[model samples]
Target chain A: MKSLQELEEIRNKTRESVYLRKDRAGIRVVVGMATCGIAAGARPVLLAFLEEIKKRNIKNVTVTQTGCIGVCRLEPMVEVYLPNQEKVTYVNMTPDKVSKIVSDHIVNGQPVMKYTIGVDGR
Target chain B: MEDLSLHILDIVQNSISAMAETIRIAVMEDDTNDRLTVLVEDNGRGMTEETVKKALDPFYTTRTSRRVGLGLSLLGAAAEFCGGSLIINSQPGKGTSIEVWFPMSNIDRPPLGNMTDTIITLIVCNPDIDFIYEHSTPGGKFVFDTRLVRREVQDIPLGEPDILEWIRSYLSEGLNEIRGGA
Candidate 1:
């Protein structure tokens, strides 16, 4: 458990040191975390990003959660936020996929074409 | 439910709702034996053997909101996946006890996450349900009890924003004392 103060410090550090996006910048990974998402196993997907970011020591990216992304069928969904690019939604992600996304896309600047929503053949 | 710690927290939440005034939670890291164990004991409304058996099933739920309940099932799965087991013991009208064990070295087992958050969430949401959480390692221990706090406030609700934050910070500090990080 992190104290509110510690969390605040983390937030402050993120704001001061990390690039502050004007609601439309930075590389963001938003995982769904509402009840449906939890039921469908979203926590691990979210954790994968956190763990990867910490392990790889990537400082520019921020991971967050949103409720009920209106994709119940794709409950464990995540949307990648790349500046000036479409918010690419990915579905049915396991924690492993999150790792792959981090390594291949966020770190290497090569979006995983196979896992993206557009490439899902939906 | 996917988060193993969340499932553990959910089970304790039910015990709180079942009229438990005093609940004790223990997290022990038996590094000597290379195991991690979680125990939740509640002096609440215990259920019959049949209900206890049913509770493990994904379909058994007291609420009518949905057809399935996966909290217990998920916990069971998590324990087994970690090369351990989950145990439930209850005596009707007496109390209930739950234990989940995990292998410390299991690769697939998820991190415990911030149990400080779990305890804070339980305390904040269930203002009346008292909690006594204890975590111990080979080196030390950390304990918290809301009733002790209530002894001074004389029944101040734990749900109050300020108090809730205090409890959370207290957990963070205590956990840090026990472990190097909280």
Candidate 2:
């Protein structure tokens, strides 16, 4: 079993850098996590985003969950909110699509248009 | 949902939606008794007796977005199908607690899939809320309380990548130890 002492060490190692940094306006990635979302496998997609973001050491990006996005068929939906840009809703999300979203949109400020709800015909 | 953990995730979402500040989840697998039980208690806005009664109805929901409220109803059905049961206890302004159990040997009982992912998702998504997760098997028991983690971490947010990774490994390791003994 892992020890809380290790957690303390992690806290120590991470605290300095965290304190040195200024609070900047960051990107927000929200996943739909209602009954429809879970039934359609939103959990993995949400985990994928978290893993991708952590693996790449992307800072200032908050990945969270929302209740529902109104369209039940597009259950596993993801909405990305850039600092000042319009919110981009990505429909029919899967773990496979997380890497590209992280690399293109989150890292390079380019939303993958093909994956957006607009391109998905609502 | 395909598995019990998914049902757990859905049920916890309802608690989060109800503005729960603290939630307790317990999963017990008893080989001697041939039972698998899950208990989730939340310090959220409680419901009236009437609301609790209606909560089991698939067509009943308080949300206006869409008409159907299937989370609790589906879980109740799943429990019944597995020769088990689901019970809800609530008092307005106090809180709510849901207990579900299944016959361990039942072939139809869904597996308790990836709890690590479910827990990680909940913690990361709702960093402010405190979650106490306790899992017990015939061999041993494992308990994880966010309050202790919060105290140890101090100012570091639980959602931080490193912290989240640590939590994931911790839970996986802890759960594996108990399940391995079983």
Q: Among these predicted structures, which one has the highest DockQ?
A: 2
Provide TM-scores for the models: 0.60, 0.97
Alpha-carbon DockQ of candidate 1: 0.06
Candidate 2 ranges beyond 4 A from true positions: A20-22
Write the residue-wise lDDT of candidate 2 on A2-115 in tens digits: 778887899998997676544678899999999999999999999999989889987878999999898979879999999889999999998999999999999999999999
Q: Give the whole-model CA lDDT for all candidates, comma-separated.
A: 0.72, 0.92
Considering just the first chain, candidate 1 attains a TM-score of 0.76
What does DockQ give for each predicted structure?
0.06, 0.86
In candidate 2 the C-alpha lDDT for residue A113 amounts to 97
Candidate 1, pairs of clashing residues: A1-B182
lDDT of 2: 0.92
What's the C-alpha lDDT at position B99 in model 1? Answer: 90
Tens digits of lDDT, candidate 2, B1-182: 99999999999988898899999999999999999999999999999999999999999998998788999999999999979999999988778999999999999999999999999999999999999999999769999999999998998989988888889889988998897833
